[model samples]
Target: MFPTLLIVDDEQPILHSLEGLLSDEGFNVLTAPNGYECLKTIDAEHPDLVLLDIWMPGLDGIETLREIKKSHPGIPVIMISGHGTIDTAVTATKYGAFSFIEKPISIDKVIVAINNALNFRKLEEENIFLRTRMIAKNAIDGSSGPILALKQQIIAAAPTEAGILITGENGTGKELAARTIHQFSTHSESPLITVNCAAIPEALFESELFGHEKGAFEGATAKHIGRFELADGGTLFFNEIGDMNLANQGKLLQVIEEKRFCRLGGSRVLDVNVRIVAATNKDLRQEIEAGRFREDLYFRLNGVPLHMPPLRERLEDLPLLVERFTQSWCKSAESQPKSFTPEALETLANHDWPGNVRELKNLVERLLITVNKETIDLSDLPMPYRTPDVQVPADGLDELAGISDFKEAKAAFEREYIKRRLAECGNDVSATAKSLGVSKSHITKLIKP
Candidate 1:
């Protein structure tokens, strides 16, 4: 687990001396006589750090440093020089050198600089990893055609300045879509401010959208910044925007259009630059028709439209979603991971998920916490979720009645029996076959396309 260091210098004495000293100090060291060899060694070894001399014969340190940065910017490079200047050091720093050291090299200083650069690199790597994990955590989880199309649309629209309107049913992930859009948008560095239009009181709507000065109102004890100001240079997500009253809608529309608003009891107009992303479970078109929402505001916010599909429409993604929720819950709780039996998954797939993804996540977490077993089964599900066990329901019988051929009817019944047995045994084909007193190949053949 020793860190590898690559030393690039024209002086063989310097290289040999540093190699011996560094090797004794517990570093896996590689020496290159010139810049060309340095680049080659880097490509071959991918060393953790580089020490480059400014005065090399061919392909001098500056040019080599540029090429190294262009190809492997993450590798920390410390520049060393016998004839050094402020300008040279500044130029190296501009070119992404981690540190610069004067020659008549002190091993103590070299070790200290190397340790600092490695620590810095480690922190940068950890930061990148955490950021990647954060982005993945907020990512939309599904592979259904609708979900894929929606993701593409978000990618296409996220970088632009145009406002986005996300519409979907309750628990259909409108808020999640908004957050994902913000995460991918150009203004990702800034905070994504969320305002629940339905939850905000009408009396304080203006104050919430635009800041109020100290003593502006009875409860205003100090200066308060509003959501719009907080969202400047970032995204402002209006959840359930369709539920915003007409009075508040007009005020919002004004700020969005003018890009400037004055705070309550403050005369100074603050110009703001914010990407607007709005979401609602209710149909805005219907709301506009019924005079509950403003048509002007709808047009302003609907520069781009995105829709989240309900869970029932993407039933094929249920298993993946279940796994994501299960792993997330298990990780957060520091508990042993649990899995769903195929029968349990089948029962879940059968139910029309009225509450969509949120409901499914809640159900999975509840089962993990409540059901004590590792494998969730069909019988683990409550009534209404598990498909009824009645022998050939009247509707199913009527459908089968159309197939008058005896062989066809027998094949249909056999297929259903095989499917049921497969689910019961958690889709373990061999286990299903053993239980049915049939060979594994026979079960596989029966289920093959």
Candidate 2:
């Protein structure tokens, strides 16, 4: 694709001459007669580079450069002047001009400057793409049923202006999920402001969320920009939002529903276009039943629901999760990557992971730093995971690959053994248990749910 340049000058002859020269040099050229036309062209076309004249009618070059920096900060502008000076060039640079060129512009200098500006823009775009990609992958790693479902929900909800409620146990990566959604959303270009509702004091909840004007109350010495204003044109991640006090929930609901809010002790109503993504470990339904949470606010926030299952339920994915954590920790710590033995991985799967993925990641980090061994084994496992809770009769090492107490391994073996006996003697629970020399309840327990 050819690089597009917008040439802005009051002189029609210079504009036409430069346009033709740049077009001949394999470029798409656009011309604007003055600052007004320049700004309009920039808004409509979003050119790769701008050649702005210092002596334009109405808004001059320096003033125009400041506005450009404010609105389209990524686009580079080169300033041109008939009477260019060191001081004038310095002033233009301060206003965000990329380069300063004297009039009687040499096409050689113009070409060099334009090429540099375009290259910088291309590099900047590549950096953004790489950054967003890394943030998404590093934030969450999984391919379990629950994780797959959550990913699909993010893909569907990201493009819209819908609010999302993320519910899960503590340390289940709620904050990362919010960031992942924002990274893929239409609001990816803007910032994602997070508010920790549980940490904020009840007395300051309103000011913290909707800003506070000067002298709004005691200790209000200066005006403050709230989370909503800072997240304008972006995402507002309300971390632990269910913990916010009941009274403040109404105020938040009003502004969120209306898309407009007033600062404390201020008459002017400020507008914001922000997508809200709230997360909590608490069960909002139970809170509503107990009258501790407001139903109206819950309904407002839960436009789409995403639940992250606690890691125990997905024991099948433990080895993959552990491997990811170990690799990430080693890479960050500048050490050789560590490996886990089959028995060690099986040890992890057998235990109840009450802390979920976050706990497993922390454990991996701990093990990586403290244990210098290339391969971590079952013997290196923490105390509780070392027990042989599920004993295998005629067990081969491969079949028992470490997870025994998860019920499936032991239950499957027992159910098949009993079925073999029942087929020989005819299906009878009492007869099978007695013949197998086990209690009837024991035989009943082995039956698959």
Candidate 3:
């Protein structure tokens, strides 16, 4: 549908002229003779753009602008004034008006302003919609067994305004977990600010989390807004919290407990209503025992502890993960979708994944690029994963030498060799069995024990 425009003016002639001019320019125009009528029209029509006159009777332009902003902040309003002044333009701009145009209006200028305002409104609305979708996707995709259960628990606890401490190994999607909780929490509509505890220098960590007033330091030219202030009425995700210094941890605990903090070089205390979500790879309990972390701070942040399992423990989900990664990479590369052969898949399934899901994803991407085959086979597998002999121990014969019967000895060797090959190739049983000159099902049976 075409965008709608609202024209507000006390002069009937001006309003009539604007309605006709803008309508001819392909806008759905609504006309109002006074501020009250303009507001009423806005409530009813919900126009995309507004051409508001500054000298309207009853409510006047500034008051009307304020009301419009409060009711529909996303809609862009251009302030039109016959006796336009610098102060009037500044006030209108400050009250969220898109632009101020002086009267004795030009039809061309009016059209330009209307089009720009409407386009700006469209872009802003699109951005908000995209951000909302991203947050929703993160929340839904975060569900993976233990993580999913923890997410549900977080949703239940988030509304209560309790502090949260998320514990997991590096790259275990801890940040994603924090974001999911924040998005589902009572503060879902509010900001979710993040601060990297490990990235920030120790000396500046306190000032970054809690704002510093002007003159607080040599480079303090102006008062700074800190993460806590920015996250007011929302959530603050402190990533790598275990890396925070002992001194800063104490201050953080105090502010979290009191819900208030004073900026550096400032005597006045600023109150905040923010939910804290701290994430760390290290064990804070150990840090406390070592006297590197404050015990009190640990308890304060551990209100609702959540631990995410590493990717290795969830090996059953590898196939699903690989499919997802491959599809995503294909889309990004603008290439046709690729599939893995049974041998290729078995090769992947047998490996001990040290780097977890992240490593697997990287390997999949590498295979897609390096392997030219439409259906990746055993030879297409990377060097480290090509065969079992390289990674398997040479204690091979010694381990199988105990079997007395020839049939038993051969079967045992076959089982051990197939299993080792599968592990080296990432678990491609077909590829491993093929390399061993045996049927896939035979290798599968031998390795069943």
Candidate number with greatest lDDT: 1
Q: What TM-score would each prediction reach against the true structure?
A: 0.75, 0.63, 0.58
Worst 10 residues of 2 by lDDT: 389-398
Off by over 4 Å in 1: 11-29, 80-94, 99-116, 258-262, 267-271, 334-337, 387-449
TM-score of 1: 0.75
Q: Higher-lDDT candidate among 1 and 2? A: 1
TM-score of 2: 0.63
Q: Residue 232 CA error for candidate 3 (Å)?
A: 2.1
lDDT of 3 by residue, 308-404 (tens): 7787666556677777778889999998899877766776777777676677888898878755445666766766666665333445667667778
In the range 270-383, model 1's lDDT, one tens digit per residue, is 999999999988888899999999999999999999989999999999999999999999999998989998877977998898999988988898777655557877655766
> Model 2: per-residue lDDT, tens digit, 40-130?
9899999988999998889998888888899999999999999999999999998889899998999999999998988888899998988
Query: How much is the lDDT of residue 118 in candidate 1?
Result: 98
Spell out the clash pairs found in candidate 2: none
- Candidate structures ordered by lDDT, highest first: 1, 2, 3
